[model samples]
Target: MTTRHSHAGTPNPLHSLIEPRALLEIAALPAGLPLLASAERGDGHPVLLLPGFLGDEGSLLALKYFLRNRGYDVQTWGLGRNLGFQTRHANALQQKIRFMHFKSGRKVSLVGWSLGGMFALYGAKAAPECVRNIITLGSPVSMGPEGSQSPPLVKAIYRLIAHPLGTHGHLAQPKARDLREQKRMPIPMSCLYSLSDGVVPPQEATIDGDPALHENIRVPGSHLGLAFNAVVLNIVADRLAQPEGDWHPYEPTGLTGRLYRLLTHKSLPL
Candidate 1:
């Protein structure tokens, strides 16, 4: 007898078990191993970095440094931690994005990890004029068929902290226009996901519709480790290097070409 397949949005408990690998990736960072090539460089545009749930700017230090070294003016999301929901949270985030756009005198790029990715998508939708593009790493954006890919522990913690803070359930919900714009995405967007991600399934981390404006890049790393993954960094650099209004999808090449082809699962546009 054949087993039935689960729906696209079904959660994967097995992937959740491997979350510990992220810790290993973090531990390896101190080894001083080279993670980026010298050839990579940005177009000097302002890029904002947002951390994952319960994460602060410190979690993205390596990524910021990598981008800075490549000539991109990178800024960190000043919000203390990613607590999912909270009153006026959406307004505050938009204010920050506007501030950056005004100060830079150009459309800014948003690079977010995990829940931060959701914010990035929201920001793009709320103010596409100020946003040039978006790049998400292991973020389970709700615009997809899947909602939150957070495991049981994370969900529990979110409920415990968010309820008291008044930023719980409903506050996190996107506005109707925010949802609609994200589905169409006026700005270019790139989603990077790893099958080995322990925090969320790969399917939940990628965009479901609109092939031309959205690109899903499959890389090798854990959900938590995506911020530090070499391949991820490379893709980030390449994407940021593109000139404004000249966006294009990413295609893995070079010595690792075969590996990328072998590892990626249905990343091309439909």
Candidate 2:
């Protein structure tokens, strides 16, 4: 079994407050170091990005611009704010994927963040033929309740918003839990997690299955800032550029390689 870094019992309540700090960090991007990748560029494939709960397309602007600059044709989940779940949202998303696949005549890659990550899993399950790969950032696809880390106040807000939207039934589905039992996804999958994630527990973010096609990348940052994290961005670019149907585990090199081994608490995949 792959070793996962997780809080032993309940997570610290204070961690939830730390989420806003990630936004502040992102606000400082203009003054921060620009990411210059030493890896291969994308082949101009189509990539779809999904935002987390309470987030919209604007939330992923930085990541979207970065990928666009790197050569991949990126599209945002044009749907409005991600409240929680709804069958209609899923249906519309499937249509979007199929349309892209049809137009490009190529399998589209799904990159979902947080709750959006859960959407990506369902998307891949629903349209494996149209999806080349699925990547999730800090999504609680495994440890639903445990990983959610939703305090009483937060839970209340979710209920109030989800009830009127009639998304509770859809969100109630146990498909995410079912993902854990599967040996592997029909499409290639990547799970990127942050050990210090405040919204979701890190350990429960990824699923354990076929090592060859399934990869768990441990990045360092808040779950909210994953889309803008330099390390995470580099990893995304590298994974997206891989030759389709010819997959391999990511092997970080140079200073990044050293950081991976030092911060990640497990035997190196190599």
Candidate 3:
């Protein structure tokens, strides 16, 4: 007898666990925070951070603080809101990249979460010479029916809230062309996904094409927790610590890697 795995409309179990946690995290996040006062002070290359869906620059404050404290020139989009996909957001991102390059006089690194990740990939594809490395957290780069593991109620709410905004105004549906084009671009890219993510499924985070240029790191945490989880933070720090032209695959070592492997084994098949 043979068992067949299905990737149809079935919801991911890990994603199922992430919904309530993400809601709680979002509610607890403080609003109207200030931008990095001295974004240009860090020693290494500059890093541009993008937030997930329905998330503004304020949502990434914790991650920004963490990187800043670690001595990185981190900057936020400073865009008013994260309503969805709009020409204005894209243009702002492009401008930010150009400004960073001009000011730093070096290729910048981009760390985007969810929708922000997609934007970062596009930015790299459009201008490969400007980006040094790219990192995405729980981004849905693969376009499929089961790309997202969000609960039905949550999905319903997103559709209800975002549908009226129209396709152009709202976050456009994931496209295979975008993923294909992104893969063709030559950039050091790392995708960090959690098996327990409640939003985007782990499989959607996998990149096809060259394994050397792309790496997939599996972390133990919920989708919301990934944005500020200690384990994820260490992984981000390790990745950012590397010098340009010296990218290496992330291998979690010692106790943390072992513990993460043990806890997330049921959800991720290595």
Best by TM-score: 2
After superposing candidate 1 on the true structure, give the runs of residues whose Cα lies further than 4 Å from its correct spot: 1-11, 29-35, 143-149, 164-168, 171-177, 256-259, 262-270
lDDT (Cα, 0-100) at 137 in candidate 1? 90
> TM-score of every model?
0.84, 0.86, 0.79
Worst 10 residues of 1 by lDDT: 1-10
Preferred candidate (TM-score higher): 1 or 3: 1
Mark the 10 consecutive residues where model 2 has the least summed lDDT: 163-172
Candidate 1 residues 1-270, lDDT tens each? 111112354346766777677777777765523436533588788999988878888999989998998998899878888776443656677888899899989899999998788778777777888999999898765434233545667667777766642323543455633553455566778888776677766666776645556777778778878887666787788888878877777766664444456555444321
Q: Give the TM-score (vs. native) of candidate 2.
A: 0.86
Candidate 2 per-residue lDDT over residues 8-73, each given as its tens digit: 543456766687778766775664344435535788889999998889999899889888888988
- Number of clashing pairs per prediction, in order: 2, 0, 1
Supply the TM-score for candidate 3. Answer: 0.79
Q: Tens-digit lDDT track for model 3 on 1-270?
A: 111112334247656754568655445434212122211234567889988878887889888987888788899888855665555677677888988989999898889887778778767776678898888887766545423444566566656655553322243444424544556467777788766666666666656545556777777666766676665666677778777887767766656556556755733323
As a whole number from 0 to 100, the lDDT of residue 248 in candidate 1 is: 71
Instruction: Estimate candidate 2's alpha-carbon lDDT, on a 0 to 1 scale.
Output: 0.75
**Can you give the lDDT of residue 242 in candidate 2?**
81
How many clashing residue pairs, candidate 3? 1
